[model samples]
Target chain A: MHELAPPLTLEQGLRWLDLIGILAFAMSGALLGVRKRFDLFGVVVLGCVTAVGGGAIRDTLTGQTPPLFLRDETYLWMALLGAGLGFALGEGLARFERTLSVFDTVGLALFAASGAVGAINFGLGPLGVVFAGMLSGVGGGIVRDLIANEVPEVMYRRDQLYATAAAAGALVVVLLHPHVTSFQAQLGGALTIVALRWLSRRGWVSLPVRRVPGARD
Target chain B: MHELAPPLTLEQGLRWLDLIGILAFAMSGALLGVRKRFDLFGVVVLGCVTAVGGGAIRDTLTGQTPPLFLRDETYLWMALLGAGLGFALGEGLARFERTLSVFDTVGLALFAASGAVGAINFGLGPLGVVFAGMLSGVGGGIVRDLIANEVPEVMYRRDQLYATAAAAGALVVVLLHPHVTSFQAQLGGALTIVALRWLSRRGWVSLPVRRVPGARD
Candidate 1:
């Protein structure tokens, strides 16, 4: 059994984490737009879309109205701030890619956990909850890549675990939900995903793949 | 002025049109999956997602729960049938691409009109309504291309008016909403989109494209 933080403190911590995730995702999207040489409007649009895409998808799936970002304009403002930073910094931000990756992982883990929780609250079944969780973690990145005309890294990057990590994390949340507080379950799930990603990066784990007969080289 | 059909007749007609659209979209998506050499499961998933994607997006945006397809299993059955046909026929279906395209256009127009009406019912502004409509028409196609790892044709196909036509059709719906019945407005909107698409295909209309400075070839 795990001890729970006070409700107010837990909520505040989650809010800050969410904001951090939003800012990181927005910057990542804006930087990609810059590299793609999209016009200024396109860059900002990509940033905002990436930041809010996952949450919006989760909310829409669960019948939440108007989406959380629309309800809370602060999220949009943060996305704009991150996008502006990315556009202004341009190539200067490239050097910090490693640091950004860490934040990206953080965002992914939290999103997967929160999405699973939301689906559970909405009475989704196990498979639905797991799928929702994975979608929430990676949907923004997928949208960013789509807009930039690139294959989504999560779909094709089989060398290291990404979506698999998210799925595992969501499964963790689902398994723990019945036995623990929601906050505890969420934290445990996030930690599990982060750990899985770290392990996969070091070649400690990997998913299997099979080449199809007669497929192109 | 226009003569209005009885409500029951209009509803049934709309239902049939919806099913036709779903079938065309599912076949198109499945055909693409086949061309890409995806597994049977992947092909079926692509087909179903393409068939249901637009209306799901529209319903979610308008705060509708479970979406229409989830509520009505007939749509899923139609999508499955279309996918099965595409898979069984394989490359042979390519010869009928022109016929499929016609049905695709019909689907696009009707979806755009219905999306605009949905947005209007949800009390969205004109811009939001128009956006909703265009997304409804093209959203499925975009998703299909994204999963297939290609640039969305609608985004780069400037030689023809696709999304623009949907937006214009939606504008028509918005403009006529206060002056006519919903059904009539939707019919007018869909017809306008179909006409625009047909005209554009004949080289009579096109959107402009500009090359950015220092961009890659």
Candidate 2:
């Protein structure tokens, strides 16, 4: 890896993808709030938390106190918009789980890339950055599962390529760092993750988790 | 500060108080679960979290990974017992908020002292230890309030004396660390917190927010 680097260019792309991804995540959170019959205020809070909870935690752990919600209201507004739309379209949205899944996947990809980017920006080494990226991308989902009183899907024996995609994307960023503008690398990383996850979903790709002969349990 | 001497009697007294205090705190956590209308499983989880969440977080920040819950089942069982009693005797205990508060104060005192001790054990000085103590005592309550969706009582400008009690107790321990066994100092600290918090609840102790003449608005 080169010791010096050029300027990062993924700013606009990252922001747009981040927004889309967060909005999708927020919609999912809103649906849960609706199912719980929470008040509108609760729905908004829950939606925003679902969108950003994990990243917020990762940032805090890295010493970004009080965190992004205190720094910007953009994400909150985006989540609010998504949740508001979701509340109005709750029944209609259920029929389009396929469409929602696509959006969720896009969000996952963008977040995975950006999570790594954010961690690297904070000067974390490769391992820490990769961990932070995965944490940021999947943390909200885990929190949602916990509150919903279900074990987090990512922790189950067969996950839907959620955390794995994030880790892969993060690894890509780590490898490409110092060799490319952060933007090109992030976009490439995001697309790679989405493609991999999409392929996994379509049964075109699968992990070889089964033990080989004589392997210890 | 005498750097070499120790107090044997104070150490023994402290040991007894710490044990009983832990039991009391764990019991209170179980009772909280019952009030939340939790099932047996929910009750146990809530109780254990209430008993240890703050301490665990504090330990994490202090660079102690994995935390005590990963190592011990004492809190879990205690919480289970508390929750069971609370669930079974819930209706009859509605009028016991006052009693709960008193018990909570005792737990708070112990928790505060323990937090201080833990921080000190982890190499923090007086200031950090005092802060840790205060956080440990009220951290679980804050988490409980967040989940319950109420404004945390500790954040309000009330004369609750919760954190204040913890800080006072921690200060006592810090000041007397050398002359007393770690146990004695901790006991003194816990008693100090309990006394202050209980007195405040009964309208006996209150702070006036000591202000300087030129203090900024």
Candidate 3:
């Protein structure tokens, strides 16, 4: 087994970034619930699930039980708050799609970085670290989609670089960890992911889709 | 934290039951993959995911890392074999719906019982034990339905007492653990689940669905 680095506390800047990411993700989930016309309970459930689902999955897969939210109810409260905000805002929030996307990107980057670091701390190999990071970034959205009875947008949507951005961020953290402080590596990785995702969205850059010959209707 | 019981090895009879359950669940998943017209890889992935997804989720939730399949390759091989069998059987398997249902019931019982036992061993409380057991029994099928882009049958299909059966089995184990040996508790629980499920199917006992008062077609 590989020796893992000790767990490190996040700096103040990273802490704020983490909180913003959680709130953004929660809002996104709540927004989806509203669009789906779910009830109040459903909206809150979606928000909490979206905000903490990724990290919970990662922690569980890495043998961290009860998850962070269960340990500290603050995460749950934040998700509920986001859900309430989304419900209150209703369709009005649709006008802020661009802004929400920015927050989502930041959240994804931070989650990817933290997931990678956490996996390494658990003595996971490179593949495990990358998988954990990507999961932490995208798992919440996937769960939200699943609850909505739809295919995960990340898996089928060729227009989005969601998983790709997360992978890149995680890879950066893993590659830099050997030569840099955890904080430095996380910072670099998060920045890279945010920039890449933002650029991709702005340029409408999409991954290639495979088409079957003569299948077009 | 409660003190967990020591891990117990499966007796010969239980081992056979376990194997049959795995095979049955695997075939069910493979059959679904065939119905969906998925590629070979997709079929296999679906099969394996269905066979192990629930236990994997439960274990992860309870802080068991690298899961049972990761530690033992037999489960993977078995799932692959199931996928191949499913591919070969094709639509022919659908003709044997009744038989398959029987197998599925057996699988559900065994999984529920074992899941409850494992949760108790992991020092879970009564509610946690019940939840873990039910999840282990039904989670895989839920995941399979999600991958196929459909609502989980257990959640929406009131006609089938799928989740109810699993929950009953789990509850039995949790309630009987204090009064009975682990082996006895598991055996009794599994039998109860199978009997309850079979009788429900035979009697056409469906859970009541609360329809919206103002709903119109």
Candidate 4:
């Protein structure tokens, strides 16, 4: 399986990035579950699903079945461990919202890079690569929100810059792949996403909203 | 690949069942999108996703890549047609709620049977088979509800016999698989689900709700 292949330098870096991202996302999911007053089992389920759901979606779409998580137990264990920590810490962790966002940003950047690389390896074009990357970044949060019976934050939240940042990062990877070493390309893509997301958050940047020509403001 | 296998008697029967199910589910999803006031693209997207989401999830879990839908265009076309009909018909289709329910029932029964059989083929244990079957039956609806930002009916509605009926039907498939012909087992299992779901609807059968002893009256 591609996921189990011996890692090159670039792949190794991406794998490490994925490990940290999965743990952060898992903890965020567990926190959401606790706030929603779910049972312990529910919390764990949410955590694991949130961490893996996006990658699973990407894999399924690209015809990579059983996903990376099922192939390797490490991802599952990390998600579970993160969920346990979230649950144990409870309300106290809520105070560290900023820290959680930073983790989320890191996860988003890494996942976007990996997803784009995977799509390219599968021989997809630029559009497909960008889409795969963006979906991988946001798919987990969407599933989490759906399970919680809320609108997906990424879909309508113009101010979030979640999908956009991923797309931008993936585009950079696609553009740079032909010229640079794979490691440089991957690192550049991920760093671009993190930087864009951080800047957007700091500046409260948002997409413009439009109203119908005849409608009142 | 399992999905690419030439059709046997049982597979042929299941294929017919799936065609009907996909169209019906697609219509339901499109109608939901219309009610939510989504654009035309959104309606079609929802319809296609709802029809295929469950099977995709099952395939991913079982290590079946590129999913059946992606492998064939027939399913995609049917979903698009269904969505178009739903959009054009608008509120008129709402008058046929009973007809739609019947279609949904047939789809649920067929999906449950196929899912169980697929699981068995993959060497999953009985519990895994049942879970897969049930998930295939309900996965589409869960995804649809999530996109629409509504609580998933199967998760929260005790009054619905959806998942219960699927589980019972899948259990029958597992129990009978070893002793009977594949066609016989699949047909019998599907019939049981359709019968139970029909009866539940006619009789207004529902699971009972409970409260904590000293918490709420």
Candidate 5:
């Protein structure tokens, strides 16, 4: 049971968190464009599109038209800002894994949570919600990999803890939706996901799916 | 505007042209995926997906559920064979700019015609049909560009006579739908489009849009 009560106020903190996460993701997108040696407009387009492309796609797929990109356009602005920001601060960001990790964690949590929320709102049950969450969290990565002409990290290296983290987080969200505060539930889920990924990277944990009867090595 | 009569046989031929074009486009997509060095499964996904992606997107935006990808997996197989064929002969293809250009012209004609057909069926007027035609033809390229981390070639460089060919072909498709033999209409439209592109490239002809009104060198 969370200490925070229902009617969770959207008074500013949560809003800002989502915004900052968008900003970070936009920067990441812009940085990619920069690495590809595109012009400024091209860089901005990549950043903005990569940042909101997943959400826009999910929305369109679910029949939510006009898309968030058309609605706020702030996401676009954020992406533009992100391009300039990335150009200026890319090296500093690369040097600090801790800070970058924090942004990545927040972005992952919001996207996954929102994806599940969106699914549940659309009258889908747990399984559908899980699928949506996974899409939301890692859809951009797939797009990113596709642009870079590489196999999607999540699709190939099955042992990688990226989309798996989001899937686990989404499942937890459904379980906790009725019992606790959305904030705590979200934070807890996000932490769990990030922790799992970090641990996996260090070989501190693994899945039980490896146990196959009569399986060839 | 004053040529032939409407006939069932013509309509049948038009459909064949459209489907053949779809298969051709699918093949091109698969070829691109293979060139990008995707694994077998990844290649198949790219091949089938790039072929169907734009139309699927147009369908979804227009409220066609499950999109075209779920309609028939035949498109998927089409892409796989296309990719395999390209993989087997890609080295030989690299030196043939003339053949590539011809194929590109045919693809533009087919895609533009089909896209117009879709939009008209959706009950849009001429302008909407025009937009639909361009989107259908260029949307796949846009997606490919984004994934390949290239500023969409459609936007940055207009030297290839890309969107214009699609729009002109679409005009012919819509204008001739009820008139001349459907086969004649479609094929004529396709031929006209190819001629326009080739003429523009060879004669240094282009639309009037330019970077700036007056800029000193």
Candidate 6:
């Protein structure tokens, strides 16, 4: 726990990862919009929203007003670029859900770590931290799906762990925060979520759903 | 603008209206949850979320963090009570969509007025104020529908003017703020929205939708 010293290298690495995650998220959103046959304006809007939605929700929950993306336009630009790329690549990108999944997982992991850290700094309890982290990881996707008029995959898709993985990652960060540097804890948390996502994708892990009698399909 | 004097009577009236709106919104959410056949816990959660979601989002956007409901649990209690009432009259209430619509309209109108006032106080420009107001009015319903796995009625249903009415109401508040008292402006705004809703519901007003070929319905 290096309280006085800053971990410059890890911090830089995390920043790069965060940017990549944002780009991936924005592109995924744009791709979905294109597939849905939304107009050009709608596609761009969806991309930007997906890229920054989770972080905005997290900031709002933690009492951080104005949101980071609004203050710093660089993130918005990155999201726009991702959206442009997605719109240009449109159908080609749609064919590779695996690639999209990888990027989405990256975004989810980093957001979970960052969201948890923000909540912790805001003096939130463990439950609040976990909830914030999970929301930050999945909020964008939920909004995207909602706009697209589909069930949010995170809520219904039991084939792979999404929110659960995020909660676990956030929990790890909270547990390890006192014993390690901030960068270390965040990195560890992100990796843990990534591992869980990968395992779930490979069918090695999944959450169970109980059958409800006479439920609508 | 009556900056130096407070309109105590109008303020009290607005507070009561806000409470009614919250209760109506919560019950609407609970009714939907019941119709969806969600568990009792899910019904309660939906109700609470629907009641508070709009206000929370508006507060966050306006830089008023921690949200009003979190700081004041009275709103949450109202939401819970609304949910209880909705659950107790589940199937019977489900048969009366018209009754629900009237309450929803009241909620929407009041929320629009308050949200616009909040944005104006926060020093947002006209566009931001209108957006915040519209979101505050329609945001809760959108979340409720999303959780229930349906397209937000505000987005798709053209039978009545919902978002447009809220936006128009917000615009009225923004326009009237400079010349009128706060209470007067808000009241004017709310009345404008309610009027629009009523007119639209009677099929006297509706927005036009252009059809796109090769688009999924």
Q: Under CAPRI classification, how is model 5 graded?
A: incorrect
Tens digits of per-residue lDDT, candidate 2, B1-217, equal 7596666675566545544555455556566666777777776666566667777766665656566656666555655565566666656756776776676777788878888887777666665577568778877766665565444455433456676778789889888787988888887898888788768778887643322234343
Native contacts, share recovered per candidate: 0.21, 0.00, 0.25, 0.27, 0.10, 0.23
Give one digit per residue, the lDDT tens place, for model 6 in A1-217. Answer: 5477755786687777888899999999999999999988899999989999998887776687678889888899999999998898898987777887888899999999988888777776665677678888988887788788876666546677887798789999999988998878888899999999989889998764323345675
Model 6 chain B — which ten-residue stretch has the worst lDDT?
B36-45
Give the poorly placed runs of model 4, Cα more than 4 Å off: A1-56, A60-134, A137-149, A153-217, B1-10, B84-92, B156-160, B211-217
For model 1, the superposed segments whose C-alpha errors exceed 4 Å read: A1-48, A61-63, A68-142, A146-217, B1-8, B213-217
lDDT of 4 at B217: 34
What level of docking quality does candidate 4 show?
incorrect
Report how large a share of the reference interface contacts model 6 reproduces.
0.23
Window of ten residues with lowest summed lDDT in model 2 chain A: A36-45
Q: What TM-score does the predicted chain A of each candidate obtain versus native chain A?
A: 0.93, 0.84, 0.91, 0.90, 0.80, 0.92
TM-score of chain B of 2: 0.78
TM-score versus the correct structure, for each prediction? 0.61, 0.54, 0.60, 0.59, 0.55, 0.61
Output the better candidate (1/2) by lDDT: 1
lDDT of 2 by residue, A121-201 (tens): 999999998898888888888876655545777775343576888889988988887899888778777888898888788
Query: What are the per-residue Cα lDDT tens digits for candidate 1 across B1-217?
Result: 8999767788799979988999999999999999999989899989988898888877777677678889999999999999888888888889999999999999999999999998888777676677679878988887888788776666556567777788899999999999999999999999999999999999998753334446674
Each candidate's interface RMSD, rounded to one decimal? 4.9, 14.4, 5.8, 5.6, 8.3, 5.3
TM-score of model 4 vs. true structure: 0.59
Weakest ten-residue segment in model 5 chain A by summed lDDT: A36-45
Q: lDDT at B166 for candidate 6? A: 98
Q: For candidate 2, give the docking quality class from DockQ.
A: incorrect
lDDT of 2 at B196: 82
